[model samples]
Target: MSSAAPLLLSPKEVNLLKQSPTPISILDATWFMPNVARNATDEFLSKRIPGAQFLDLDDVASPHELGLKHMMPDQKKFSQACERLGVTPSSHVVLYDTHSVFSSPRALFMFRSFGHQNSSVINGGLPRWVHEGLPIERNSPSMIPSSHYEPPHFDARLIRDYQQIVENSKLDPQTNPDAEIVLDARAHGRYLGAVPEPRPELSSGHIPNSFSLPFNLFLQKQGTPDGEYTTFLPEQELRAALDNVVGAQYAEKIISGERPVVTSCGSGMTAGVLWLGLSLLGAKNIGLYDESWTGYAMRPSSKIVKTA
Candidate 1:
């Protein structure tokens, strides 16, 4: 795989790559909420990209006693999972999900955190691929067992713990110039405490000083004769959205690498969308609060802010 791979690939680009002599390693990282009746694995088994393997989010995540979902796994565990999925150091890993841009970014985040930079996500995921008449197969791809892929140490710089977030919450950016910006990717209602969280045990509120920029804002819907599909917005429009959420000055600072950003969401899934958006804008200093609100709100020591 070329190290200079683009972070996002269109379905047309992906289709052309599949026809190459050495095709890319495509992963179906489709996942859904517990209440959703869909089974990602079963769906993948029935229909998926022609040469794609399934990446079970639950199987790769660390088992949390507190039930914090989608927590990053240890380097060894992650390395094993990738090897089992036939990913190698030279593989140009391409990730996609059944939903329109939902779960694939999280899987891409996991790859980047594990030091695999030679990877990309299908821009509109499987939905858009199907919408454009891309080839798919019901049978699983033939696996060429990876020769003990060694994952580099998990990038600590891309991850934030609960305590780190709490400390950040107490800082006033006005007082501390280096204070990081925290952005939540949950829905507006959930961020405002006006909508109940899907997790019954958790309350709906945001971390102090965190801005709510729903993950969907980064994507634009395109209506076709077949149906509607979602894809990332053009760069100019995305920059405008960022400027509107956090002033133009702050957005410029982030793009210039002078300011840092940490993204969070209900259980740390959609947070990747925020991280990916920032990265697309050329932001180098970005982190994911893996535990996110699920790990934060449950702790009595952490403070929660409710606008509604």
Candidate 2:
């Protein structure tokens, strides 16, 4: 297999890494949270999978936009970033991260947003990779200078902003042209207004007419190092969790032929995973609430936050 070959795999498929399959491009796409002190590129250069290369999230994003940290970059910057990483349009991207605990889903989003369908993250990320006893490399390859990686047309409508969420509420289904759905990715307590928020500045609780689907609940229970904080249920478990997560309120919206979804998280971070899961399951038209809870929560006039 060439480095451009596809590398999507499940835990069952992880054994192939031990054999050092050719043609597959594996990316050590590890990223740290904003609060975490370590730098990803420095860590990537220190050690990674045998043929694995570094895919910097910051580099992949729009450098021009200073307002939002890690918001998806525009197409020109996205194309250039991929090209710099030797990612041709034909490249099969497999992302691995230290925070399988978090960033893997974001990587999946970046790939899809760029219209590269042949990309998936390694389950449990690098920690799981090491757990499987796969080959590790310390030497950084001589930098492969970048080349052409053309991008598909920028799909502006594919993403939605805070104002869209407000507009969505006022849409009358019968008179409305196209309907939209909003998914709340906060914990159930926050969604239901039972618990206070992690971000103290924002008001607690979910947006109006939003479906509550806690992102952490999807984590595989066994894989998470911090059991209480994040849990990624396996495939079957995820489906089951989705049933519980996408409860009566949202299900009614979906069944009524309303639009599919636009996921919302505390500060627009974890909802990327919600969108990714929905996308993987064939939900064709979905977006993220870019301002998310922060947008609504911070606003005193917003009608949706229920204290009870």
Candidate 3:
């Protein structure tokens, strides 16, 4: 909790700060899967944390100009959106979602990319909070009046374009070596081409030379059967899980800002979860492949590996 980097806050930790004089902004950034019919806005309107604002990921954080889903917006657009949400530069933002650890991490990563250093994600999101008997509001909270928000120079190092990914995919540690490590956060079945992709046009498989480390591995089920919620593991367990993929020494290098980590997923959404995990460990050189497999699969020249 005392670390300089962003950390996940427990429900109890959030409750203790209910009376703190510092400005804390809560954001409900719930985003459902494509097949799910539930509307996040309607859910937020029905019930949400007290004083929480709704951030529509598809609307507020996406770049419509690129014709892609949930792409990061430019600095000016992101600044304007944050201003409309009444998020000042000094605000300590806390994001949560209905689906536990799914969508909130994306919002956290977005905030960090925009140079907001004080952002964090609730460990188990709304479900855990409700399960813990914390207070909730039925009516939609009134939005604070707009404020001015100016972001620092946008950092391109936090993002990896398709060309960069393609180039990285070709590097072989056995022969040509590089400091960059590419991680894929998709299911093992999807990564091995044993399961079909959600998108029909995109083929199932993974980027060449990328290691598989599904994002859900970091999450553990909490709460009772009636209201089960997913939350991140304890620091020791989380570190062990990460060390399994990148080895303990390399993981330490990543945490100490010595090596670069690049994360990718089906369409770039779950990649945020991996980015968040690295960020929690204080990894400074983190990058996300914005287009992910959706873009890579469509390119005939891109290298893809399938176990089956």
Candidate number achieving the greatest TM-score relative to the actual structure: 1
Local accuracy of candidate 3 as per-residue lDDT tens digits, 38-145: 999999999998988998888865553336677887788788888888888888888999998998998888887877878889989999899888999997588699
- Over the full model, what C-alpha lDDT does candidate 1 score relative to the true structure? 0.86
Q: Which candidate leads the pack in lDDT?
A: 1
The digit string of per-residue lDDT tens for model 1 on 1-308 reads 13747999999998888788754789999889877999998999899888788998888889876776678998888889878888877778999998879888999999888778889999988889988998889776666666557866787889998888988988875467778899999999999999988887788989998888999999999887878878899889889989999889989988998888899988888898888888898999999999888889898887889999
Q: Estimate TM-scores for all models.
A: 0.96, 0.78, 0.93
Model 3: pairs clashing at backbone N, Cα or C within 3 Å:
none
Alpha carbon lDDT at 133, candidate 2? 64
Better of 1 and 2 by lDDT: 1
What TM-score would you give candidate 2 relative to the actual structure?
0.78
TM-score of model 3 vs. true structure: 0.93
Summed over model 3, clashes come to 0
What residue pairs clash in candidate 1, if any at all? none
For residue 124, model 1's alpha carbon misses the true position, in angstroms, by 0.7
Candidate 1 TM-score, true structure as reference: 0.96
**Per-model CA lDDT versus the true structure:** 0.86, 0.65, 0.82
lDDT of 2: 0.65
Ranking by TM-score: 1, 3, 2
Please, what are the lDDT tens digits per residue for candidate 2 over residues 108-142?
A: 77677666777766766666656566667788655
